[model samples]
Target: MFEYLTAGESHGPRLTAVIKSLPSGLEIEVDKINKELARRQHGYGRGQRMEIESDQVLINSGLRNKKTLASPLSMTIENRDWKNWKKIMEPLQLETEPQKLTNPRPGHADLAGALKYNQKDLRNILERASARETAARTAVGAIAKQFLAEFGIVVASHVIQIGNLKSESWSQLKQSANFDLDSKVEFENYFAQLDQSPLRCANSEQTKAMQKLIDSWQAKGDSVGGVFEIIVRGLPVGLGSHVHWDLKLESKLAAQLMAIQAIKGLEIGAGFEGASQPGSLVHDQIYYQPKTGFYRGSNQAGGIEGGISNGQNLLIKLAMKPIPTLAQALASVDMISKKAVSAAKERSDACAVPAASIVGEAVTAIVLAQLMTAKFGGDSLSEIKRNYQAYLKQLSEF
Candidate 1:
């Protein structure tokens, strides 16, 4: 239903994206997409690139007068660092002024990627391999998030933990949150909200605690990880297919989540916790009523069961490991010397758990939008709206 590709290196001239098959006549908002790129650069532990780059979307194709033309949409987000790296990342041969990387971090794609590709310069591998690629993904996902908004569908995410001090669970916080779309409130429009507390939390008390915890651990020259949950509401059921392994909605979504940097694990409902419980206790009990279409006693399945959504909130939780680039660095062998060396350390974040959540939301939005279009395929916005309305009617009457 939806597919995207990204190009450019970690410190390349620009991060380029091409998103194909978005419905025609859908309004394109430059600010909305730029804001998403801005969000991706946020959180507690970001490096120097964030300082230099002021990401803005330059619409190259698939748009006319602020509307889609039913063609492959292309956008380029300029990397501010590109000016300095013009010679370094030039597509043409650079006379091999070797910027060779010898050390490979344990948790990164350094050594294995180079070995697999048979490349001497690890920069060749690490460029495409860097978390910097997420900029392209996040840019495209912002468009996906906009598409989701076309329906009453809403997707929101929040940080639950930073390191050992876990933040509050998503469902609970969402229940207590008060945001009026009419009023238009948004966080993460800035560069540094990572210290905004325990959950990278916007809440005052929690944000303060998270900041303290980060400061406490900063001295050890180590980084911390955190948990975040994404909730998709107003999604009609049956967006995924059980017919094919590749077509399964959960698998596609899980694969996207795992694609992020330092993201070690993902869970739908009970996730790992459900593994310890019996079937009777772990499975969500479905109940139908006049008020709600098909409600569940508990969402242990994380909104999808048997590879298809069951009309419940699509809840997905992810656990991110600390970033591999740390000041103290982990022990690793230098590829050139074949001797032990400390992991490469550039300017890195102290904690990126919060920023990771933003990426999680972005990635999930793209997946959900893809699934939505898969089930309700249409070329134009008007046609998609008609199909979506019919689907909603079917849902309501049932």
Candidate 2:
């Protein structure tokens, strides 16, 4: 099995992660991980923190000569902003008092976390609850992406809706369209087009309009949020088991997607839309080919059925709510004084949907990687590939 845990405050000295149970003999590069980290910081509405922090991962363990050692992999990313908060965030007690947060933002974790942890200052909660932690997750997912790439699986994501502006292409995809989806080359071309966009959007005009909307919100001291779609291509059948509810791939994917900060909702394929459709329209029909084995006429089920992958492209959509921290703080109460006040104003982004899409891809990659490890059951990459090839042969013969 593969699992990872992250630690550190938003403005702490560094964010650290420990990823365990990776097979040995898999090559990894620091630049690849750093590239994903850089992507997490990109977007039009990012805060000053993005400008201050240049996130780069430092691999401390579980790798030798750019290859895994079949052990726990440890990594860290320094917080460049730590210098400004050193006196305040010092490990030991400082001679002078540091700034404390008494007012809690309406939609943030400040109030709830402070109360749960029995903390007097909301800073204790905000430090760890911040979305800054996703940077560490992006690094871990980058490794998962590299691992999956060896098996010819590709995971990618792109913005679909930014507030009221929607991508016409994505809308068309939501509806049943007769297209040449059986060709992997065709889907690769589509992914390539999305890759070229700064917002990870397939439509250039919508992206431009989305940028304008973000600029407008910034001027208003407000924020906006939207939805993004994640795509996983070239997955082999039967990565997840249907025997147990906990092992269901859809459940696992939903759990990870919801865990991301600011994400309010998610759907798989024609998820909510399928609720209104008839049985024939909602379900994907199966067909068999002499060369390709099994296939689906439509992917309304999103490449998953009975908790296992069905060898079709997996599609998932996530909805992120507008960021809670406003330039002009929301109405709030001062916990210390017990009086009404404007909520604490901290530097914040007007919209993070684009960056959140990258994070969605990262989390999805991790889940797929874990499924690969569990199914292949190998101590090394070569062994995994050997097992995988044998399984493919068995499928072909079946």
Top TM-score hit = 2
Q: Could you give candidate 2's per-residue lDDT for residues 1-398 as a string of tens digits?
A: 45999998988899999997799999998899998898889877888889998899999999999999989999999988887888877777876888788999999999999889999888889989999999999999999999999999988788888998988434356454355544668677776676557677777888999989989998999999998999898899998889999999998898888999999998888889889989988888878888877777678888899999988889898989999999878999998898999998878888999899989999999999998999998899999999999999998899
RMSD in order of candidates: 3.6, 1.9
The whole-model lDDT of each prediction reads 0.78, 0.88
Q: Would you list the clashing residue pairs of candidate 2? A: none
Model 1 residue 25 lDDT score: 89
State the displacement of the C-alpha of residue 334, model 1, in Å, after optimal TM-score superposition: 2.4
Top lDDT prediction, candidate number? 2
All candidates: TM-score: 0.90, 0.96
How well does candidate 1 match the true structure in TM-score terms?
A: 0.90
